[model samples]
Target: MRIALIGQPNCGKSTLFNQVAGYKAETGNFTGTTVTFTESSVRVGGETIEVVDLPGTYTLAGTNPAEREASRYLLSEDVDLIINVLDASHVAQGLELTIELLAMKAPVIVAMNMMDEAARIGIKIDGPALQEKLGVPVMPLVASRGRGVKPLFLAALRMGKKKNPDTSNYLKIKENDRMARHRLAGELEREFVKRGDRRVSKRDRLDDFLLHPFWGYIGLIVILYTFFQIVYGLGVLIETPLLAFLETITSQAATYLGEGKLFTEIVIGALQGVIAGLGIVLPYLVPFLLGLGLLEDIGYMSRVAFLMDALMHRIGLHGKAIVPFILGYGCNVPAVMSTRTLDDPKERFVAAALATLVPCAAILSVVFGLVAFYLGPLIALILYLLNIFIIALVGRVLTAMIPEDTPGLILEIPPYRIPTPRTVVQKAWFRIKEFLVEAWPLLIAGSAILALANYFHAADFFNTLFRPITWTLGLPSATGVPLIFGIFRKELSLVMLGQALGSMSFDTVFTSVQMITFTVFVMFYIPCLATLGALRRELGTKDMFSITGLTVVIAMITALLARGVAMIFF
Candidate 1:
């Protein structure tokens, strides 16, 4: 039997899924985590049943791809039962979705999730009365803490047993009953929702200050600054050991090869490629993923999104775009996928294009390596600010170009909670696993291709071919090779840079101004192969090539201008 879980965004659908499935699916306060359907099996009544968790949606009428996907799934997919998770604190909004779901005539068991939070907010739910009114079972649950979950699961099992059930009887409402339904719902809410006796404390005051518009911006900036600081410090702390470990492996491999031409090439080349790629990636990627996972599990990401909504609105995107932008910091592929949350196609396209401007894990890893080895943390922070500036500028341009109306913010801001260690580790592990599964093959293939190119001197050949442009941009001929490889993989640029400039310190090989110019050029260059592939699939080949051509031109112009200024100043 198949039981499908569905709900509006941030309504604890994922949390409930995790509870019943006995698996850890990362639950974030933000919308759109489950872009694709995730399935697991759970044992209930001594029988195994498959449970599917669909992406969160605001309503059946939503135009966003994720929402449309969920709505389509409900209409087309054959399921034994539907478990509709709702936020107890926001029943009015949650019930709107329930009403729509009922219209589909599917057998639904309502789970009013986050009951603990609702009670704290002086809101309550009369499960029995609500069940009687809707003619469907209502179960109150706190999925995060494992509260009232058993009953919810049992109810789902019971509901699933009754196939081809008469849902019409459950949803029998008069055509002119809008006013009566509203009044009934309001009366039930008034009777059941009891005010809590607990008074607001100092921590609540602190929360108020932090959540205020003016102070919230300050807090966001501070949080972002601290995040970078942690990333930098952790990078430095881990780099020396990582380098040592790679060097030991490389030395061992060098000895094993014993200078045979073919063996030496394969072994040393592979070692150099791995060290150049993995060594740089592991340090920053590990910490960054863990930090992000912790923040997400603890619900702080919603606050960040809420704070950034005002700025996002200026770009004709909703506040939820912040989640994708943040995910872009980890990888642009998922970030592009996350753009499915934006209801407007124009907004989705613009968001996907501009999201590419946000540096991903590979770029951040390279930045950390460059900063620690050459530019220092302060300059790294400055580059981060510059990145944000570029993203905002690009967003503004895209918004003006596309000019589509986007929906206003209607997101639920989940209260902050301490992330359990088990939850955090589970989420981090899942993310790391995902990264490895999706990116590792690409990294390995890219490394081998780059090694072959260097072995056959194809890279050198390209450098010579692009000599005129390289000279014009004030970059050494060797820089062209890395720039070309960067189009395939951004991290490859760093690896190639390190290999090409072997034994030469960045400070000695290039002036500080030139290094800065190179970094800026790399930052603005064409999106990597994976991103380009996604673009092609999403926006068509013509649009993909157009964007690629535009990015290349912009990169060249920016590099030239930067180099000109650098030459004049330094």
Candidate 2:
């Protein structure tokens, strides 16, 4: 049997999905469009059931891309059962979506997630009464704690086995009537929900300082600074020992192949890239992703979007664009895919365009490994700030050219809660493993290819081709090689840089000014090939090429500007 999990945003649907599915779900496209859903398999009743976590939507009739795609999927009737998750603490608002889902005439088991929060707020929900009224099984769960999730799935499995499951009479009578559904939802809320006196809670207390206009911005800076320290500090602590161990092993192997044969050189080159990825990049990425995951699970990310919405509008984007922009810091692939949530196509295009320029973990690894390792952390921070400025400027220009109506930011600020350590670790590890599985093969192959090109004098051809541009930016001809390799993977460019210079110490090959300039260029240049594919899917062929070309121009100008300023200082 096939199962679909649907809910309104911030209703804990994703939390429940992750708890049930583990880290096994893959992002699947919806009808070959840019929109996507998470899919996995769950074993129930001695049979494997395919489950999909549909994109969250407040209504089936909404025109947003997520809603449209979800509506299309529901109409196809491919799903055997739907598990409609609701925020138990706010069932009145959540039941509106649940009512709409019930109208589909499919078997649905309501998962009233976050019962703990509901209880804390003194909201007493009679689960049995809700089940009796809805005419379907209603299960309460605190999904974040793994409480009641198994029972919820068991209930879904049982419902799936039935030939024809009955829905609420309210759904049956008002399947096509929006007003009637709303009225029915309100009636159900009054019938099942018993509210207590309003009281301030821990989340409410934190929000007082976190959402304050003046203090909130200061808190954001402090949080970001602390985040940077954790990622970089932990990465350095781990990278030092790991790189030492790997260098010893690889150096011994290199000594064995000291004859300088072409095959020997290729083998060493590939090892170097592998070492760089494992030793240099993964060390930083794991901690960075862990920190990012913690912020997401703690609900701070939404607050960031709320805080940045004003700034986003000034650049022709809105608060919604911040979701993709922030996700871009982890990986641009999902970030671009996430643009599907934005209702405006013009805004989606602009957000997608700027998201490519946001320095992802891969690019950050390169920045830290090269710039911070040789120059200082301050320079790395400067490069990051510069990237943001470039994104804003580019977004402003794009907004003027393709003007469109942008809706005000309408977002949910989910209550902050302490994330389970196990979930955070698992989520971080999953992302790291994904990076290794997808990028390693390409990195290893690219290393061997670049090594062969150097051995065969192909570097000279690329050098001559890129000389005018590289020279204008005050970069060496040899720098052209890594810039080209960066298209495959941003961090690979740094690995290739080590191979090109024939040393791990970058200071010997370039001055401080050149290092700064090169880092700036790498930061703003083309999105990695994976991100390019995502952008192509989201923006189509013409826009993909347009974005790619535009970033290249921006990179060149920025790099030259950095070099000019650096020369004056150094």
Best by TM-score: 2
- lDDT digits (tens) for residues 150-259 of candidate 2: 77777778878788765545345524567877787788889999987887878778888998999999999899878877777887688779988998887788789884
Best by lDDT: 2
lDDT agreement with native, every candidate: 0.72, 0.80
Candidate 1 RMSD to the real structure: 4.4
- Looking at model 2, residue 535 earns an lDDT score of 74
lDDT of 1: 0.72
Evaluated at residue 208, the lDDT of candidate 2 is 88
Q: Candidate 1 on 105-137: residue-level lDDT in tens?
A: 568888898898888767767788778878788
Candidate 2 Cα misplacement greater than 4 A, ranges = 25-27, 43-48, 164-170, 245-281, 323-343, 359-387, 421-441, 474-478, 485-519, 528-542, 562-570
Quote model 1's TM-score: 0.83
Candidate 1 shows a clash count of 0
